[model samples]
Target: MILTTHILSGAALGANIPNPYAVAGLSIVLHFLQDTLPHGDYLNKKSRLREFWKVAVDLAIGLSLVTAIVFYKNWLSDEVFLTNISTGIFFSLFPDFTTFLYRYLNMKFLRPIKDFHEGLHCYENGSRRREFRIENGFWDIFITLASLLFLLFLCAG
Candidate 1:
């Protein structure tokens, strides 16, 4: 799944769930479970600079959207809410962070984490082009919209 989808989904979970620990654990678990769904995998074996730029832009956009939501929902005033949300977002992205460390930084210690992350992907069978297993069109938009709606529902109630 795209970073924006992960961010929004995690934020939605955080916004309503009162238990920070539950939010954190569930966010991480959801990250892998979502990966099992057929979604876009834009990162390819291209130029390192190109991949880095793509990730940076996506992450920037995701975080920016999260920031806007926080302000719009007046979540900043509540420290506990803020912490839970932040934890949700962090854990949700933690797997990808470990992947980056292993792939880009050669952190062999994170090999197991990276393997587990990739093992959950829809096309982990090593057949077909993994990067092109799915296109970045429908699923991204659907998940993003659904998560946004969920967040709005929680906030309104």
Candidate 2:
């Protein structure tokens, strides 16, 4: 799943769940759950620079989309709202961020977590084994739209 979808889903979970600890724990779980689903990732292991640029662009757009949604829903005005949503977003992206660090910095302590994350990925074998096609961007839009709609429902409720 795209980071944007994770962020939105985490935010929705946070909004619905009042307990901070539960939100944090469930956000991380949701991150892994989403990754286990068929999704498209644009990262390429052969080209470091190209992969970096692609990931940078994806993160930028994802953050922008989250910010827009927060502002649109008037979530910025409430302190509790800010805390929960930010916490959710942080935990949701924490796995991916740590995996990136482990890959580049070769952190021994993070190796376990990285290995666990890779183990849960649906595309672990490669895109050929992936049920979804990256070329068409179908899963990307499908997941994003579904997440956005769910977020809206959570916010409205």
Candidate 3:
């Protein structure tokens, strides 16, 4: 499945299908890839990325709620905001929610997936793909290229 978090789907976003549904669908795939990537983040028993992501997510959500209260002046009437959030999460899981479930299951029933993520900033992948499987910026480059193409297509259309 080329569209399965492979980055090329980001390129296809440029095709400009004109149907908001299609664009929305593609965005779902993009977000899934983004969420699945532990690039700027990773998870392990003693995972720094996991810790950071937890704090970041908590802070962001808290800040966003405060901002919403300040901006809207009526948090009680924020049903639309809630709806949009539900939609966002719903759309975000387009490609591989099952994989997430599988990971949970792995940790629940089986053993923790090893070869745990690493901290490889400003360092090379050691002359081998396997060495860098956890920290290869090349994947992000491919994804960026695809996203760029998709944005271009949107502009063209």
Candidate 4:
């Protein structure tokens, strides 16, 4: 799934859950659960710069939306809200961050974590190449839309 979808989902969890520890744990669980769905990823991209730019833009947009939502909900003054939401967002992205470190930085110590994360991915024909194709990423697009709608519902509720 795109990082934005993950962020939105995590933000939803944050907005609802009162406990930061619960938010963190559930966000990480949700991140892995979402990854178990068929989705696109930049893992196999050839150009590091291009992949970085894509992730940077995705993160920027996701964070912006989350900030807007937090502001709209008037949670800025609430320390607990900030902590919970930040924990949700951090844990949701933690898996991908570790994977990036293992892949790009050649962090050998994270090999076990990287392997475990890859093992959970739902790939077609055991091929990572298909993950970059637009046609194969319909689920990602759909989930992204669904997440946005969910957030809208939360805001209105």
List the candidates' TM-scores in order. 0.86, 0.84, 0.32, 0.84
TM-score of 4: 0.84
- Per residue, candidate 3 scores C-alpha lDDT tens digits across 68-152 of 4324444345454334333433443333334343444454432222112122223322333323243544555566455444433
lDDT of 4 at 29: 91
| Superposed model 2: Cα runs more than 4 Å off | 44-50, 130-139
Backbone N/Cα/C clashes per model: 0, 0, 1, 0
Candidate 2, residue 157: lDDT: 30
RMSD, each candidate, Å?
2.5, 2.5, 10.0, 2.6
Question: lDDT tens digits, residues 30-126, model 2?
Answer: 8998778666666533336445876777678777877888878877777787788778888888898887787776687998998888888766635
Which ten residues in a row are the worst by lDDT in model 4? 42-51
Error of 1 at 110 (Å): 1.3
RMSD of 3: 10.0
Off by over 4 Å in 3: 1-27, 33-38, 44-82, 93-97, 107-157
List candidate 4 stretches off by more than 4 Å: 45-50, 124-129, 155-157
Which candidate has the top score in TM-score?
1
